[model samples]
Target: MNMDIKEIDGACHCGTVRLRVRLSDGLNSARRCTCSYCRMKGAVAVSADLGGVDVLSGADALAIYQFNTMSAKHYFCSKCGIYTHHKRRSNPNQYGVNAAILAGVSPFDFAAVPVMDGINHPSDHAGGPRVVGTLRFVASPGE
Candidate 1:
């Protein structure tokens, strides 16, 4: 899929954690996982190339949570406790931006995106599902 690379704005539910990301063309390709946490939170993730994402505001308001192998760092807004994004254990260079946190984005079909087996996450990343979907952002009316 062809995508335009540009800057997109995102934030948490309470708007406490604002972010600016240099969205890559591949961002349109997303991944849905059946992992315990992912299932519970209903997160649709898209990877940003290394150093592509930038936290524009509320950096101090962000809180990180880690569990299990503790390789992934889940970042959320401390005040609202809304999960906004995370640094994946499987890939440190890429950041997983939560689709829900992005403003002006509509719900998408999971089937269109690739599915990952985050349940039994691979250690060496030799065998794992790949992400293959695109992300579209529409500017909210009146900015």
Candidate 2:
């Protein structure tokens, strides 16, 4: 079956955090991390090369939270505390949008999505795994 994918609008439950992202081609194609915060939040992360995601509104409404190695920049809504997305510590240029944040995207094939070894991260980072695997997109207005 050939399914047409398009840019979908997304936001936090509170509407404080808003985003625009092109859907990934398949289901369960997002990465699940075992890292501390990722485990806690249970975030299913789908990343674009470096420019795929667009933050449409509420830049001021979003808050940046950093911890541990201080490399990853975790972005959440200040009022709702919903983590919308993050920038990789290994690759600051790329944006990792929480697949859960995207509205209308299916999770039917979620189990098929690859589970990346983010627990032992820099090793994966150094080998260019992050850059090699995904389709990169051009940055839109609010990115």
The model with the greatest lDDT is 1
**Model 2: per-residue lDDT, tens digit, 1-143?**
22344466779879877888764443233676667787788777776555667788888989998988888889999988989888887568666777767787533435345555567776444564432232233456795
Cα lDDT of model 1 by residue, 1-143, tens digit: 22353667789888878987766554574677766787787777777766877888899999999888888888999999888888887778778888667666534533355667777676546775544333344556796
Model 1 spans > 4 angstroms off:
1-5, 109-111, 130-143
**Model 2, TM vs. native:** 0.73
Best by TM-score: 1
Worst 10 residues of 2 by lDDT: 128-137
Candidate 2 clashes between residue pairs 3 or more apart in a chain or in different chains: 28-109, 28-110, 28-113
> 101 in model 1: Cα distance from truth in Å?
1.7
